[model samples]
Target: MPLSTRQSVIIALIVASAYFMENLDATVIATALPHMAATFGVTPVGLSIGMTAYLLAIAVFIPISGWVADRFGQRSVFGGAIVVFTGASVLCGLSNGLVEFTVARILQGVGGAMMVPVGRLAVLRSTEKHHLMRSIAYITWPGLAAPVVGPALGGFISTYFSWRWIFLLNVPIGLLGLALTATFIPNYRASTHRPFDVSGFVLSGVALICLMYGMELVGQLHSDWRITVAALTCGAGAAALAIRHLGRAAHPLIDLSPWRIPTFRVTLDGGSLYVVSVSVSPFLLPLLFQLGFGLNSFAAGLLVLAYAAGNLGMKSVTTPILKRFGYRNVMIVNGLLTAATIAMCSLISPSTPRVLITLVLLIGGLCRSMQFTGINTLAFADVPPARMSSASTFFSMVQQMTIGLGIAFGAIALHAAVLVHGNHAQLSLADFRVAFLLVAVLVLISVLYFIGIEPDAGREVSGHTRTASR
Candidate 1:
């Protein structure tokens, strides 16, 4: 049965809430690293294992999500995912050592890998064509807002309360999501099922894990460049092999047919650029404040509030903007502005007025929100209903891979600047400037892709008609 409007709304809300819990769990650890390290008796960098393990686990499992959900009912898998994630969160909060925590994180990743992609699949299946833009916008906020505010929120909690609360807080949210899922989310499975592609899963998992972990390696300032290069090379090769196999295999784990769709293809290309570039700001901005401007953790996190505020502040107007300007125009213009705003950071230094900095970040956030909404809305507009699950899985995998790539690229930019300038000591403002400029250039490349999008693209989803004046 096609979902009624109220039912669709419930599904979107339930899925968004679940994703918020998942994303918040993934991101909130950013600011609590110091406290966690102290308690675990390790360097701050050493604690990254917890984060990387979770990411690698997610990347490894995400490719199989669609198939798994199709084999089992979505309701069963979704509920199980929440249970696993929530239980893992509790275990993470209780961990006393790095090994224990890393293990728990991987378990959490198993749940999250299933949780996010399947939830998205549910929304795509339930939402009507006309309401896709709003449903997509609803789901996207948790993905954006959680990461944006996670550092600040984490810093506050760790400073005043305990880092344990970061994970423990998920219990209630997860319970609520689980309850709502049972009441509101419908069970769905593919009618025609094929044998599981164990080899494909193996190859894709290896590719994603190596790529993401390699990036994590690149981020470590003191790591061996040789190992980093090797891991990245292997990741590239495995990815190539995986793609070839998926394209050729009759029962491939990941169905790649959806990439043939022009709208989906272009959105992926353009979205990758935005993801890689913006990925830097979150990791870089807090550091720039702390290392360059000499702000403490609490103050640095608070400073990032401007960026987070900017990220969320534009949400209310995104739908209207897309409706008025259309997806293509908004993406090209808004994406360019977002990139430009990132480059504008080069102008910020110790002497820059605080208010001016906040204003710039606020504007940047607004631009980014609009760009993401346009891309996400337009992505699924042309996808066939039968292929929705496959499209969701492929899209999620791409997002995971590119975000990992962005982090690595951000790390490399900083490392490159440090090496070039012979700043063998502390990172100076000059290093951050180099990183920002390079990443911004990467973002500008996305505009070239966006230019190729046809006029009146995604009109049905955005309600933008060719006859109407902007």
Candidate 2:
């Protein structure tokens, strides 16, 4: 029997909460870094290991998440992951040394790698086609809001309380997530499981690890460019090998068949490119405000609140908008608007009115919310039920990679601007202008991919009525 509407909504919310917890944890640590370094008796730069460790862990483990869930059961793996993550959070809070903290973060990543993809798989298996958009909307906001909100929230908690509270805060949320997962989540497994693809796993894992580590290197303000290039090159080579191997393997670690589906292919290609462009904002905005606009970190963080408001503002109306406009029209139009807003950031100067900046961010947030929800929901609109596991896993992996790429893209753009102008010790307003324009261009490139989408594609889920051709 299909899950009732009420049950479906409940499961979606529970999964959303778990996603929120994971995202918040990932970003919340930034503001608390200084305090953490003080406690650990190390430089702030040294603590980057903790952040990189978590990311690398997630990248290495995500490819196998689907296989593990199928080998076990979704509910069993999901609940166990929660336990592991929660326990690791406690360990993070208690750590007095960098090694201990980094290890704890890796453990947390392992749990998170399994938690989200499997939970999403369960949701897709249970939700009716009509409900997919709303279900995706429910889950999308937390990921969007967490990055915007995390810095301010972390600053507040770190200033008034101990930095340890940052990790410890996850305790209650994780505990509640555990209860919900065990009670409501179904234990799904493959009826006929394939043997593990050990070779495929090795190739994919190396590719992701190198790619992520390379991006991490690029994002750092002071890193060896030589090492970054080498890491990225190795990642690309390994990725090519992984793709070739998966195509030939009898029981591939990740099923590449989803790429043959038009809707799913669009999401993997166009949607990922869009993500790379959009991801640049979070990395760039704070630097723009602090370095370019002469604003304090607090004021800069406050400005992002407008963006977050726009995200929440659109949440209630996304379903209606999609139903009215359909995915193809909505994504192409909204994506352009999103790029326009991003480009507008280049116009902000010290003298630019804060209100105008706020308005721009608000509009950008709205467009981002709609475009992301549409792309995500539509990816699965045409996927078969049996392929949900592999589809979700592949999508999750791409999402993670693109996010890392976004940050790297922003950092590299800023670096290039610096080189183009006379090399300076500190970045200037003109540097930001160049960077924003470049990021905007990245977004525009994605539109070419979006243009390939079929006119009536994803109409089934969006509920958009197609008019007959005259």
Candidate 3:
């Protein structure tokens, strides 16, 4: 049975809620690490083990989320994910020691790995082809709120109240989302039972965990180089094995054959690059304002709110813009604009007017939001119906890798600049300039990928036709 209009909207919102909670939890701890570490009687740096644990849990489990959802059922698995996430959040808040907190976070990461992709599976199954673009836009645009809100909210809560409240606050949101999900999200699953690919799962999990963890280690100033090298080499070996197995396995965990599709390939190769750069901005911007500019956390967060507003404000215009200009053009133009805005950040200083700084960030947010929605919609526009689940899972998994790399890349840039300066002094504005410039150049380079995409490439989803071309 086709889902009704009202039901479809509700379903999209439900997925968005899960995505929000997941993104929020991922970022909120950044601002509160000092306070969190104080309670555990450890240095802030020592508590990075908890962060790494959470990320590792996510890497190990996400590759299987789609298969698990298929095997069990979407609604059941997604609902269970919410329960685990919510319960784990409570545990995180109540944890009294570093070990306890790390364990809780690992549990939370398991929930998170399923939370986004499974919810997405439901949406992709329920929404119609013609309505796909609009439905996706509805779900995605709202979740952008999490990254911006997480930093500000974490800073506010830690400053005014308790850091634990950050975790506790999700309790109510998760419970409400769970109830609504049970009421609305349809129970969709594949009819035939596919044999589980145990080898593929293990190989992929090891590959991702080692690769991401290695990337994180490389970014740390004190990390051992030999360990980083070993982790990266092992990750590469494991990934090669996984790819070989996937090619020969009957019913592999995910089908990389989707890469043959031009849209999917560009999205995977090019879109991943853009995500890495954009992801760095959230981590970089707050540090720029708070550390480099010597602003209080509250003030820095207030400034970041401009970027959030720009992100949200672009939602109303995104669909129409894609319809008007088409994916290739919009992605190329808006992408460059986004890169320019990021480069513009290099020009900001304590002497720069607050209004000017906000304006630059706002424009960057708006452009990046359009680029994100466009790439996502186009990636699926050409995908066959049968492969939707696999495509969604694969894309989401790749996104997780790049998002993790983004923050680490930003950290490495900052630390590298500090090293070059040969100073024990605190991070200066110049270090941030170096970081922003590096990432922005990467973003600029990705624009060339869109040039390879045909002008009419995503026409079905974009509703862009020759007769309507401007």
TM-score of 2: 0.98
Residue pairs that clash (backbone atoms under 3 angstroms), model 2: none
Runs in model 3 lying further than 4 Å from the true structure: 419-425
What TM-score, over all chains together, does every model reach? 0.97, 0.98, 0.96
- For candidate 1, lDDT tens digit of each residue in 275-304? 888877888888899999999977887777
Considering only N, C-alpha and C atoms within 3 Å, which residue pairs clash in candidate 1? Answer: none
Q: Give lDDT: candidate 3, residue 8.
A: 82
- What does each candidate score in C-alpha RMSD? 1.4, 1.4, 1.6
Q: Which candidate achieves the best TM-score against the true structure?
A: 2
**lDDT score for residue 231 of model 3:** 93
Single out the weakest 10-residue window by summed lDDT for candidate 3.
Answer: 137-146
Q: Candidate 3 has what TM-score?
A: 0.96
Q: Is candidate 1 or candidate 3 better by lDDT?
A: 1
Give the alpha carbon lDDT tens digit for every residue of 62-168 in model 3: 99998998888899999999999999999999999999999999999999999878887788778765566777877676556678878788878987899999999
lDDT values of the candidates?
0.87, 0.89, 0.87
Task: For residues 325-399, write the lDDT of model 2, one tens digit per residue.
Answer: 777888889889988999999998989888999999999999989888988898998999888999999999999
